[model samples]
Target: MKTIALTVATAALGTDAFADSSLPGMTGTDHVGFTVPSVDEAVTFSQDVIGCNVFYPLGPFSGGDSTWMADHLNVDAKAEIPTMQLVRCGYGANFEIFEYTAPDQDTKLPRNSDIGGHHIAFYTTDMDGAVSYLQDKGIEVLGNPTTMTDGPSAGETWVYFLAPWGMQLELVSYPDGKAYEAEYDERLWDPRP
Candidate 1:
């Protein structure tokens, strides 16, 4: 495996080709958070079901923000609201999964049908294992891991699914992924190391 140096939170909040903010209630990467029905459930799926090695328990415990940016530059310095758990891929970026307290509730992304919206993607070396693990756990995949015939990833295989909390999640694999780390960018959604 190899390593890249961009801060997970920073890259997650950067501009895309169009330069519009792709994520809402987010800024400076770490400002992003996914509200799950249960923090423990979210942790299990990301760890055992998804085969990710858990990092600090319920961690980065402090210092993650979920406030929208006043300016695209970043979240406010004084921004502090709810707390979230940060997880990273075995070798890449970090993901922040938040559990609802009482006032907070699970919310939807802008919806893929709507513009400036999206789903979180997870990379897998074994797409079959990835699918099977989730399925065996009674987690149904929303759709098959279809092959992309479109844009930058004109020939990638991807499967879309939903987390217990209804947060959209995706699993993806490529033919020559051993060298995939070199092409890392703000778009790569990795698990916590």
Candidate 2:
């Protein structure tokens, strides 16, 4: 795969994008945390099904029965995270899965269009092979992958699917990189070596 580099002058991103003063200037992602109904099952799916490695053992944690917990996590102060475990997701972000129990926690899974409805997209080198593998494993692989026809993201392929728990997930692949990356000094999806 080939990647193109561009002059910084031509790549006109606003300075405000780098002006976050809260955490000693923003760096790359550390991890992505999400609550699951069962930490053990989530761990199994992540490791055995999704090919992530369990970086650590599950452990119990709580944010304490105070306004701080509720205000920050949007869960009841008395919420109890019975277990949590971290997993390394290939070359990208880590996953922080938790099994939480709270009086006000909603059991319904949210759709992508709903508020706070989100899906974690995993990058792959082979979109068709990945989709086929997932389908062979009896995973609910959604329809065929869609290739972008135009725009900055042109040349990438992606598809959406669901986990056993109904949480939406996505797979993305761009072996040749994207159109916008050619006009920027840095890249969001760097070509694999």
Candidate 3:
């Protein structure tokens, strides 16, 4: 597997990204978090549009209102912390939704290059076919599905796309999974209590 260059950030601290996650039974690191504007809207898109399942619901009592943690615990009684909806891919992998009560403006994940937040990847048995279905639904396809001829994912194929609110997603078909294995390492994403 050929190594592809991935950017690594330098600063480190007890920020939200640095907060020690109390996710149960997890010993490795958590990669990223997704911040959205509304839990209800996020639920609609993820369930109706993305074809995922609700794994768990997150409220401030559970995960805390960082960005996706919408209403402050004291601000909105029902919304003590922001509400988080965890959605699962058809195959079983999960992506979480975080909708904080922020302005409906683009904050960080505007371009495809921001490397801090979460980017959910869905595994599709057929790559091109999946891309066509999404595009037909009026979703924004980020160019074409590129079959990697270089790097560890050399034989793997990926097509990038964005959710209506600008959350990034990927449709992927791996002819061989060596690259993904190396990258993800079978890491369990949810460990928080």
> Cα deviation of 38 in candidate 2 (Å)?
0.8
For each candidate, give its TM-score against the true structure.
Answer: 0.58, 0.82, 0.60
Best-to-worst order by TM-score is 2, 3, 1
Model 2 reaches what TM-score against the true structure?
A: 0.82
Q: Which pairs clash in the backbone of model 3?
A: 23-191, 23-192, 24-191, 60-81, 68-98, 69-82, 70-82, 70-100, 73-80
- Candidate lDDT values, in order: 0.61, 0.80, 0.62
**Candidate 2, residues 1-193: lDDT per residue as tens digits?**
1212322422455455555547675744778998888888888888888899898856666777567668887778888778889998777678889888888889999998999899999888888889988898788978889999799999889999888888899999888788898788766745344
What C-alpha root-mean-square deviation, in Å, does candidate 1 show against the real structure?
A: 8.9
Q: Rank order by lDDT, top first?
A: 2, 3, 1
- Please, what are the lDDT tens digits per residue for candidate 1 over residues 41-152? 8888788777666665453222334334324414353333344567775564577666543323225556777775678787777788889888888886987788766566
In candidate 1, where is summed lDDT lowest over 10 consecutive residues? 61-70
Q: Residue by residue across 97-181, what tens digits does model 3's lDDT show?
A: 6765533434566555555555677778778788888989899999988888777666678888988877778887764553545
Q: What lDDT is reached at residue 40 by model 3?
A: 81
Top TM-score prediction, candidate number? 2
**Residue 60 error, candidate 2, Å:** 1.9
